[model samples]
Target: MQIREATAADWPAIWPFFHRIVAAGETFTFPTGLGEEEGRDWWLLAEPDRTVVAVDGAGTVLGTAKMNRNHMGNAAHIASASYMVDPTHTGQGVGRSLCEYSLEWARGAGYRAMQFNAVVATNSNAVRLYESLGFEVVGTLPEGFHHPVHGYVGLHVMYRLL
Candidate 1:
């Protein structure tokens, strides 16, 4: 597998998985019923921010990630990122590769740290992956996210120094 910068053309390949993940309401807090255009605009960020896709040898997109500043102005030194892997591609290290790529990008771009603003507590795989990558749970807002099946759950604020 390889990680590379995403282009507008990649949106079509990304949209199916992105839409399904967001609509699942099990992990991400993204609004359900979001249209393709809006989702594309939200994920494919502009300059100074980055969007990437992970692909196999055959060039099939397996996952994607977007990295950008966690805050503006005085707090701009921090970076944040989000990831989505194709369900058929999970357990293949796609998410981890995207995350590591984002970290490298953040460090090269001079970010002091990376912070994840809203990590669903019930997403153990993600929580574990972030922890393995050196992120720590700084705080958790009780009953912050309303999981479709788990009902209300905590939203963890995860952070790590670059």
Candidate 2:
């Protein structure tokens, strides 16, 4: 899969996977019923924030990610990112590449570290991916996320110094 910065025109391809992921209400905190326009606005980002996609040679979007400052001025040195891989394309390393690219992007942007604020603990695949990428579970907020099928689940705050 090839990773590249996403252009506005790519939104259409991204929407299908994005919509499914958000609607599942299993990992992301986005409103379970978030609509198209709002989803576009939230993911497209602006300025210092960046968005990217992983595509196959045929130009199919296999996954996507967005990166930005973890917080405002006081916490700007730390970076934050979110990722989504097409369910049909899961286990093909698309999400891994996105995470790797996001880290490199943050480093190049002079970020001191990267922090994932609310990783649903039940998402073992994601937790393992972050750990493999050098992130540590610094803390877990008890019952922080309401998983659609898993009831209340802990949310991990994973972090790593760049």
Candidate 3:
């Protein structure tokens, strides 16, 4: 697979899986039933912020990630990112590749650290992947996320120094 910066045209390809993941309410905190345009605006970030897609040899988008400053001004040295993989493409290392790429990008961009503010604890695969990549759980908000089937569950704040 190859990783590359995403273009506006890529949003159409990304939206199906993004919509599915967010609507499932299993991992992300995004509101279910998010509209297409709004979702596009949220994911296709601009300028110094970066968004990328992982694609197969055929150029089919397999997953995506967006990285940006965790806060503005004085806190800009810190970075944050989000990832989404096509459910059909899970277990294929697409998410791992996207995450590794994001980390490289952040370090190259001079970020001091990367933080994930709202990782759902029950998403063990992602939590494990992040941990394996050097991220640590800095804190957890008890019953912070309302999983569709699991009721309220903890949300982890994960961090890694670049």
Judging by lDDT against the true structure, name the best candidate.
1
lDDT, candidate 1, residue 43? 98
Provide TM-scores for the models.
0.99, 0.98, 0.98
**C-alpha-based local distance difference test score of model 3:** 0.96
| Candidate 3 total steric clashes | 0
Per-model tally of clashing residue pairs? 0, 0, 0
Residue-by-residue lDDT tens digits, candidate 1, 1-162: 999999999999999999999999898888988889999999999989999999999999999999999999999999999999999999999999999999999999999999999999999999999999999999999999999999999999999999
Judged by whole-model lDDT over C-alpha atoms, candidate 2 comes out at: 0.95
- lDDT digits (tens) for residues 54-160 of candidate 2: 99999999999999999878888999999999999999999899999999999999999999999999999999999999999999999999998999999999999
What's the true lDDT of residue 128 in model 3? Answer: 99
C-alpha RMSD of each candidate structure in angstroms: 0.5, 0.7, 0.6
Q: lDDT per residue, candidate 3, 1-162, as tens digits?
A: 999999999999999999999999999888898999999999999979999999999999999999999988999999999999999999999999999999999999999999999999999999999999999999999999999899999999999999
**Candidate 2 Cα deviation (angstroms), residue 8:** 1.5
lDDT of each: 0.97, 0.95, 0.96
Candidate 2: C-alpha RMSD to true structure equals: 0.7
Candidates 2 and 3: which is better by TM-score? 3
Q: Candidate 1: RMSD over Cα atoms?
A: 0.5
